[model samples]
Target: MKRLMKTTIAFILMLMLTVLPACTMSDSAKDLNSSAKNEVGKSGESITLRLTLWGAPNEISVYKKVIANFEAKNPNVKVELQSIPTDYDTKLTTMVAGNDEPDVAMMESGSIALPLAEEGKFLNLQTFLEKDPDLSLDSLVPNITYSSEVGNIIGIAPGPESYALFYNEDAFKDAGLTAPPSKVSEAWTWEEFVEVAKQLTLDNKGRNAADPEFDPKNIKQYGVNIGTFWGAYSNFIYSNGGDFISADGKTFALNQPEAVEALQKLADLVNVHHVAPSPVQAKNIPATNVALQTRKVAMVVDGQWNSSSLADTNTNFNVGVLPVMKEPVSTVVCGMFSIFKSTEHPEESWELVKALIDPEGSIDMLTYGTWMPSLKTWYTEDELVSKWTDNLKSRPSGYKDAVIDVMLNNSHQTPTGYVKNFNKIMDVVTPALDKVWLGQQTAQEAMDAIADKAQAQVKGRRDLE
Candidate 1:
């Protein structure tokens, strides 16, 4: 009898502990729903908040219309969009250090977003998220929610981004080859890509890279141009089953067999194959949009952001899915609007965050081909997808498959971006990698030289410690 009473009492206590909170949460969520429909401010009240972002003038022009629509939705709120053009990440650091950070700042996923969120500089979004039950992250691509979190969510993404092949159709035609595949299902293999690049590469004497007499120097056109930046190289690293960080996330993985092989391939493009311009010459090439369209380069590895510029210029180009190496994979980028912990109006700032991500609000940026909506409803609900994509002049041919389909199925998170103290780790590793880029040494030799020190920084960096 005593044992039975004790067991019954314990079970009752456990149920109270779990069930009571769930009931409370249900009520809280309901209350928040009610508040959302009502104006938080008094009738006709007004507030102004500074929103920081970085983009070219054309991007800014479109964002202004987005802001106007947001303002119309909440008549009392005025959002001033401030564009930070150069060294955007460093500028954001300065703002945080000076206590002059904007109420809502656009934070790109990866290293930049991670450190700040970990430091508690951004608001703890747990309560905000719990309260706003209507905010759906269901459609957010993989790694987005992870980037937004460091124990607690510090932000919510407005849209997601990924890399894809952007090729000049005229360049391909001139090379006597058809354009590369537009869909991921038909992506070119690394060997096929290199051969195509050779066809497009030409010298002043009109010799292609495939020609035995092709001049290595004084080349008039490169077959392909690959950026050394993270966004571009990462796709190669991942596709080859290599990564810069170890699986445990505590050490450098750049010296691994897979990574070493991948780096060698990148170096080979400039040094051995001569299909791409030299590292020095690459610095002088025009922007990807201009170089591809003007026939200075045949194909370029770049992000989806170039889509808008290409559309606006009416350039003769087509989207190509990323080339496959040992596997089919590519890196993705997601950008979010985060409220600072110092903001006087947390609720109002959240309102802006919503307006940035909501299906209705994000369509302007989405249709322009600069972003993929993070809302699942946008893709799953025809009424929603058509609402934004249809009648949008900026969307390119096969965008539905190349951008949307790939984003949903093919893209993966960047490893270096997620690892702690990654920026410091890269600082040690980049110079060593640069030697490979410049053809001073093979990738294996250069990375092996710096492997120990790079891992040291990853495990016990001074700044991050």
Candidate 2:
């Protein structure tokens, strides 16, 4: 049931996450950029670059501003913005089959971009990126950069967003517990987190899960809601020193002992400890902010984009580092900005890609809080971090240590970013994991049953392997 709810929410949030915020820095564009405009025609005919992206109307509206800015700087170029809000992947396929692919596209990493890049559909921007005076592949965060071949850059994530532990401060006070650790080194251990949960989880008769007379069936407020989705759960698998796929990308590894142990601990929270709500019970819970505000659950594991949603709630909520099993780990997930091989104006399209991804170009996006900067300097340099986080209501005080520090020092991009045929592999793996969430099978039993089928789809890791 958690999977079912998350599937629906993921579709909407994933779409929300994929929308790229356009640059509004018109006055300083020339001062900030050193690259010469690659004019389309020597004869002065206007070159129109077709740009395709998926987003809601609100997101699309901001993107149009970005396009307008690009056009302002390069007066000879015209950009036709094609916003596909629904059936994006299917429509992109239709465009490909019809030989009408857009000049540039914002691609969902695993589902659309990597598979197409392997088939030679997207342009290799390696040479362009290397020669660019303003930015290089090294300018971005290492985890968000990708290449199908060594030194052959294919696509780069336009922004970065990762998973973190969000909790209600008021709930913590009620339980007489301190807030979760803000720094990675101070993160709680698995046992410590469970013990805290037991104290917070309450029954109808005002008994905690730790109470001898506590009744699981009468649970009124759960201590936590652990996401069963891969994006949320995979952090734990990696923290336990395991992975869904091997680093070489040729093996299915979720059946390994380390992975099994991490997953079992999460299951134990639901079935054994009863500190977490069961799938059926969770169906009634609202969104993350509402749940925390209503005190339906004390803590939730979710993406950083929830920061904006959390700001609207009256609850005194804050974020903290996820507990460690062995390593302090979090998963970063984002779509890549890629130029299609079909583009007649690769130079101009590359310019558009660079403009959209530059953090300075999209500062409004960062301030509004659905996105994080894609560049490493944004995390490592205090000046850059302050540019986005300073006095920003959505960014709580602990954000620097809990979100920024962890992303820089202890983050891994989701397997979807690098693993081949990731969507296909998940199709075989998710159903088996569903049984684990349902309490119908142990993590080991469920994974063992499907490992063979999942392994058949393992081709090789595509990104920087």
Local distance difference test values of all predictions, in order: 0.76, 0.84
Error of 1 at 244 (Å): 1.4
Clashing pairs in 1: none
Q: What is the lDDT of residue 198 in candidate 1?
A: 91
Query: How many clashes show up per model?
Result: 0, 0
Question: Candidate 2: deviation at residue 98, Å?
Answer: 0.6
User: What is the alpha-carbon lDDT of model 1 when measured against the actual structure?
Assistant: 0.76
Candidate 1: tens digits of C-alpha lDDT, residues 1-465: 447645755565556557667566556555544553463454645778899988767567766877898888778889988999889899999988988989998886554676787777788665676667777444355555543334466766677677888888888776679888878888899999999999889999989999999998878889888868866888888889888787666767888898888888988999999988766988779998889777788888888878877877757888778788887776876667788888887888887877777656656577777777777667667787777667665555656667777777777775534566777878888888888988998988988899888888775211221
Cα lDDT, model 2, residue 235: 94
TM-score for candidate 2, residues paired by index: 0.89
| TM-score list, all predictions | 0.83, 0.89
List where candidate 1 sits over 4 angstroms from the true fold. 1-48, 76-83, 86-95, 109-112, 146-151, 380-383, 386-394, 459-465
Off by over 4 Å in 2: 1-45, 463-465
lDDT by residue (301-342, candidate 2, tens digit) is 898988878877677988999999999999998877888988
